[model samples]
Target: MAQETDAPQAPPSAPTAPARALLPLILPAVVVGVTASLVFVGVSVAAERLQQVLWGPLPDALGVGRYSVLWMFAMLTATGLAVGLVVWKAPGHAGADPATFGLNSPVMAPAVVPGLVLATGLMLAGGPSLGPENPVIAVNVGLAAWLGARLLPRTPGALWPVLAESATIGALFGTPVAAALVISEALAGRPMRGRLWDNVFAPLAAGACGAMTTTLVAHPAFDLGLPPMSHHPHAKDLLTALVISSAAALLGMGAVHAFPYVHAAFRRLRHPMLMIPAGGVVLGALGALGGRLTLFKGLSEVGELARRPEGWSAGQFAAMAVVKLTALLVAASCGFRGGRIFPAVFIGTAVGLCAHALVPAVHPAVGVATGVLGMLLAITRQAWVSLFTAAVLVASPSVLALLCIASLPAWLLVTGRAQMQLREDGTPVR
Candidate 1:
């Protein structure tokens, strides 16, 4: 017997293009981008100066070696106290709980600005394994949205947060492309009527402008001056990189799984004054164990680690990674306002260096890049950003191929795992 014929399927509809942003939209985007860059750079410079004083002549004059474990302990403990005070006194409790704030959170109120700035600066100058990215982004988004509302009262409210976040990210990485990748990932698979690139337009424009402004004000280097990569990585090198990177990814995953518990424990105290300082004491002890090089947000230290990978023994590198990871867990869980991306980069560098120390045959550039790739992918769960950061930091064409291949195994290790965020009510924020 003949089977019933299946009905013919209708042709798929062509995708609709997003409407172009008019002059009014572009104007506010430009304004927001410039303002965000200035605010971010200003905070960064102020924090740098404070760090120089705290870790420099101040320590020297006090007859304490800057690298002393005891000094790190004292400074970190003091930092915790200062941040606690800022959070306690600042308006709006510094704009929502940081534990609940992911990379893409709502715009904070302007009232939250002072406390965020103070706490972020303290984290930077103190010995926390956190960076200013999160707090700075919050400040810029809040301030920018307020400014945008004033300038273009009739504009869509959604545009402001996107523009502000894109601008801050651009200023942060010194590149518009990084912002695009990050935003694109966040927006992926969401139900939207327009083409993805169309949705990307305004943010891209803001990011480009922000990157330009940041470059003019401060020429920060993402590349850490790693040695030239040798000839194309060998097969064995790729395999070794996969192994090393996977290990690092697993290490970060361990922290991710523990994040919620640690954050909840800290929250049990229910007061920033009690919670923050106690976290600080734990961080100080970790800093003491890891040494001063393991302190801070770790951008500059990553360069140092990359520049002289040979100077560190395998045991030393392991110690650095363990201590820094511990410090990151404490600082983030204890309510310090900062980003984990930069510190994760440092941890990845330590992991990479340790691999190199243990296995002499692994290329330094390959080892370092893959390790960074793994940690970033695991911590942020952003593959493109992780790849971009790793490639830019090394600036070596030869290692890129190996890093790309190594990332697959690393991704497998991290996929479907708990995210490194703390949510209220004991629910994990993935």
Candidate 2:
């Protein structure tokens, strides 16, 4: 079925040594990092202001009491409609669908940036259960790639995507190390002419700069204010972590299994205008049932759950976890532009808190970490990144060993299982 070429084939260009390729990228990498951080800060600021308007003054003006379930429903519906409009009208189809793409998808064309930003801003302000990680990464990568082409035109084309993704990850997590782990894991087992670290050098520089800049500007906080595990770990703690982490992985897998069916259902609706607002209605109902704490991407909400585990009963925590998971499924499946990782983390926190409540002997910090590790492993299917996130977020250096031990059981549970990502054909792609 293939046609043969009649003309002579062009010879491949000579490869540049890794060191020579990286040398000119040093300054350009820094500039890209700074740009990505500033862009993220701007988006965050805008979303915060929108949140205030929707949750604060708008409610007062409308005379709806704070925390009114009806207001939550209305706002989410409006948000869905707003996003539907953007998706309907945006250039380049507003880039790739999040369901069909990974964190490191090719950079989108520059024309799609406006629609992407607006849809993401609306989703965040409207209190979708998804987070800014996916959309923001796309935005930064597209912009960074475009800029890098102009300023460093001679840089290897492959390196531009790496720089953009590195900067975005660093900005998102506020850590160069997170970017390093992610990139290293992504590149593992791939055939390369040079050492893996050699290719990573430029991206790492960009990531470090991005992390520093975002920290200085946004002060993005990941630590949950739980009491540290100051005492030495007991054998019982290891047992507790294994049980909790495995259980959490199983819980996360339940959502993963349901993902393809739910995504198909949404796609069956066949139009963004019909599908997105309907999804929003469902999210609003879930919020009404689960309360304000269950709304939004679970960044601050997860921390709140950890900080005040005593405030919720086991049944209440269970409800929050389930509702949050359902919301994530609906938002991601029904054309929302965001990442599932943050909401999954929130669900894990709720599950862990519930486990701790049931068995009072386990330390809350350990419970939370194991739960995070398991859920992240199941959802992302990346062990190193999950392990790093579990250890880093707790901010307790002493528990790293315990978390490392905890992750093995979770990995066993999740290995060769379903993944959360979908293929271009609208089916889950594990």
Candidate 1 residue pairs that clash: none
* Model 1 alpha-carbon drift over 4 Å, by segment: 1-23
Tens-digit lDDT track of model 2 for 16-127: 5666666887897898888888887888789989998989999999899657988988988889888888998899767777888767766889999999999888898899
Q: Whole-model lDDT for model 1 versus the true structure? A: 0.85
What lDDT, from 0 to 1, does candidate 2 have? 0.85
For residues 134-159, write the lDDT of model 1, one tens digit per residue: 88888888888887788778888888
User: TM-score of each candidate?
Assistant: 0.94, 0.94
